[model samples]
Target: MAPTQYSQPERFRIALGPLLYYWPHATVLSFYAGIADSPVDRVYLGETVCTRRHEMRFAHWIEIAQMLREAGKQVVLSTPVLVESDTDIAVMRKICTQGDFLVEANDLGAVRCMERRPFIGGPHLNVYHADTLAWLAELGAVGCTVPVEMDGPTMLALSAARPAGVAVEAMVWGRMPLAFSARCFTARHFRLRKDACEFRCEGYPDGLVASTGEGQAFFTLNGIQTQSATCLDLCAEVSAMADGGIDYMRVSPHASGTGEAIAHLDEIRRAQRPASPSPVMPADATPSNGYWSGRPGIGWVAEEAGT
Candidate 1:
């Protein structure tokens, strides 16, 4: 069958991506408690990063999902980006078979585990074309998040040719997850083995920022995941996204100021105007939107540049 054409929603939707960092159990609960009352239309839960961060097990995530559902928000469970061990596969199976909440499949293994059940294609699924989107839709993907490195025009083209009933989501905010490895960089950074690393990632709630020899901010290391040094803020592109048939704008969770960030984006979406480049990051962090404009991932292209 041919790939389905893109369909736009009457109103733009905002989703909270899965928490990529490891926090204490209380902190995680507290964060979602606040999210239950936020303007976010959907909330993605579960550990999409390393599974060693066991602050919240699958049951705990379900509990949070139940609470959020009661608050009138849609919830999804996200599988890990990298599935290294049998334990990971087992967890993925548990999440896929639950049939309670929707699942976001980050890897193909998770996709297969879902057994044609409706799920969301996560950013790491590497879907970059209409054919791939169509294949995923055939496998029961209700929506697919564009890869972080996909440029804006490319996303528009893909959206234009996407399969029917498959909505397109974009990562409009947060430090972009660049890559994943079986080896935990955080463990190596701490001079310990990956298995004996003693949960050091929890120390850096926002991931550890790697710097160049010249002290320029480089990649951020969060266990097995490598991320951009600067947060990707596409709030300024909300109007363009709406014009291009994007269905949802995703904001990855951060340690602080996420509530305010969600609020700011909500206001811009409701007003249906050009965004004013609000402060979504902490005072110390930098913001970049170059990937959306077909520039280097670290570069920030101004709205007036139009290039």
Candidate 2:
């Protein structure tokens, strides 16, 4: 597919996606305190994963948002991906009506609550085609974060057909969130009941790595969300993304090295040079960009190989 021409700023915005793992209350606060000075242009706050991992409450998130905003960063609150109960619905409603910051609607319920109000469509919405993008734009989606599984050609096609005034954002870094379940895998792994899971996920600040029978790293198990074992590093594709009409690039938060990742991307975006090897990956995790290359999600295709 040919690249599309869309109205975009001079530089592609760098966004920090919401925290996906549970952390200690002080750790969460310190993380954002560091992020307040990072190069990220936009920040997505709030708990998007399991609600049981509540080290920080809604009020604390708002306080952090205000602090980040004070630091001259755009702040957006993210709604939970799975609405399993009435309590979840009520929380989603609260996020949609918060009125202070922009909201990223991760589910249909959030979209409904945000009708006629501007929002950013979260990646879990599975908006693969232009029609779905337009439908969302009509319902007040100022931008849409395309699914992490979407390929480059598909993104270009969707960008070409996107409605006016709507922007496209893509996940450029971190482990891809593959699936979510009602059952808490982290809890189950520890042989605990879902209701009485004891918040064991807190122990894995970056999610527990699950290996295959042969002991190959496969997936990272959070409470309910299953993520890729390898982080997705698309810093090398920054130019291609800008050319393909992607306005924003999101970097998912890690327990550590998030600032370094942001700085690395900042350098690449500013210099418009080829990206160096990412410095933020944990010692055990490798980098993968297979989904961007139309390969297996776990596969890694080198930049030169793609060319």
**C-alpha local distance difference test of each model:** 0.87, 0.88
- Model 1: lDDT of residue 263: 85
Residue 273 of model 1: what lDDT? Answer: 37
Clashes of each: 3, 0
Off by over 4 Å in 1: 1-10, 304-307
What lDDT tens digits, residue by residue, belong to model 2 across residues 1-307? 8643222234688999999999999998999999998888999998888777678889999999999999999999999999998878877898999999999999998999997799999999999999999999999999999999998899889998999999899998898999999999999999999899999999998899999999999999999999999998887776678878888989999976678888887877776444555667854788888888798878878762234
Return the lDDT, model 1, position 28. 94
lDDT (Cα, tens digit) per residue for candidate 1, span 129-217:
89999999999999999998899899999999998888999998888999999899999998999999899999999989999999999
